[model samples]
Target: MPKITYITFDETQYDVEAKEGATVMETAIKNGVPGIEAECGGACSCATCHVYVDEAWAEKTGEPGAMEEDMLDFAQDADERSRLSCQIKVTDELDGLVVRIPESQA
Candidate 1:
């Protein structure tokens, strides 16, 4: 299991150990994190799982795929760091990852 630290715009933070292969949004929902609403379950159709990966951990999470990239155009504040959490497959490399919920999502 890998631990994910989710931080909200208000600076609230929560840490939880997640299933080895579950998406980051799944882990956030399971831990009752304030933001992160996986509206489309683990599907990439919705931008509700939008999150901003901390600059320090950006490379570790990698970039979004074509579908996710296209979907993100509808997000509130799509930026270089914006990502659909449901599209992220968990891995040991993502441990201690810091994801900040944007004000729009919060």
Candidate 2:
């Protein structure tokens, strides 16, 4: 399992262990992290799981797919680093990854 760090808009941090192949949104929810509201589950149709990948971990997390990109338009503060946590798969390479949850989702 890879440990992912989720930081809320207010700077509260939750470090959770993510199973390989599970999405970041799933990991957050499993750990009771408060910011991610994965309304559509792991489906890419909703942007409720929006999060900002820390700059240092961006490349490792990779870019969003076309469908995910389209859905991100509904997210608040969508930016180069913005991604739906449900779209991010956990892997050993993502250990120690840092993601920031937006205030809008809180």
Candidate 3:
């Protein structure tokens, strides 16, 4: 399992172990991490699962596809590092990934 850290706008953080194939949003919801509503349930239709990839981990998390980028427009505070957690699949390389949840999702 890969260990992922989710940092909230309030500065609170939750570190959870996730299966390699699970999406970041899935791991978050399973662990009851706040700030990720995931309203679209892993579909690329909603931006409720928006999160900011920590600067150091941004490149590793990769860029979003066209559909996901479109949905991000609806997310508050969307920026270059912004991503839909539901679209980020967990992998061994992401073992120590850190993502910050926006205040809007709070």
Candidate 4:
């Protein structure tokens, strides 16, 4: 498992272990990270799982796929670092990764 830390806009943080092959959103929802609704069950149909990848992890995570890129269009306050949590698959190399949750989702 990888330790992923979700940092809220208000500075609150929730750290959870994410198993390989599970999406980041799955670890988040499982650990009660506030703000990521994952309303579509990570099917890429909803924009509720929005998150801002920490600058350090952005390059490692790579660019979003076409579907995630399109769904990001509907997210609140999407930016260059914005990503749908469902698109981030967990991996051991992602240990200690940090992501920031937007206020809009809270």
Query: Which structure among the candidates has the greatest lDDT?
Result: 3
Candidate 2 wrongly placed segments (more than 4 Å): none
- Residue-wise lDDT of candidate 2 within 6-103, one digit each (tens)? 99999998988899999999999999999788988889887999999999999999999999999999998999999999999999999999999999
State how far residue 22 of model 2 sits from its true place (Å): 0.5
lDDT of 3: 0.94
Which TM-score value belongs to model 1?
Answer: 0.95
Q: How far does residue 1 in candidate 2 sit from its true spot (Å)?
A: 2.1
Work out the TM-score per prediction.
0.95, 0.97, 0.98, 0.97
Candidate 1 wrong stretches, greater than 4 Å: none
Residue-level lDDT of model 3, residues 24-64, one tens digit each, is 99999999999889887889888999999999998898999
Superposed model 4: Cα runs more than 4 Å off = none
lDDT of 4 at 76: 93
Once model 4 is optimally superposed onto the true structure by TM-score, how far is the C-alpha of residue 40 displaced, in angstroms?
0.4
User: Per-residue lDDT of 1-106 in model 4, one digit per residue for the tens?
Assistant: 6899999989998888889999989989988899999999999989899999999999888899999999999999999999999999998889888999999988
Please list the C-alpha lDDT of all candidates, in the order they appear: 0.88, 0.93, 0.94, 0.93
Of 1 and 3, the candidate ranking higher by TM-score: 3
Q: Would you list the clashing residue pairs of candidate 4? A: none
Clash list (residue pairs), candidate 1? none
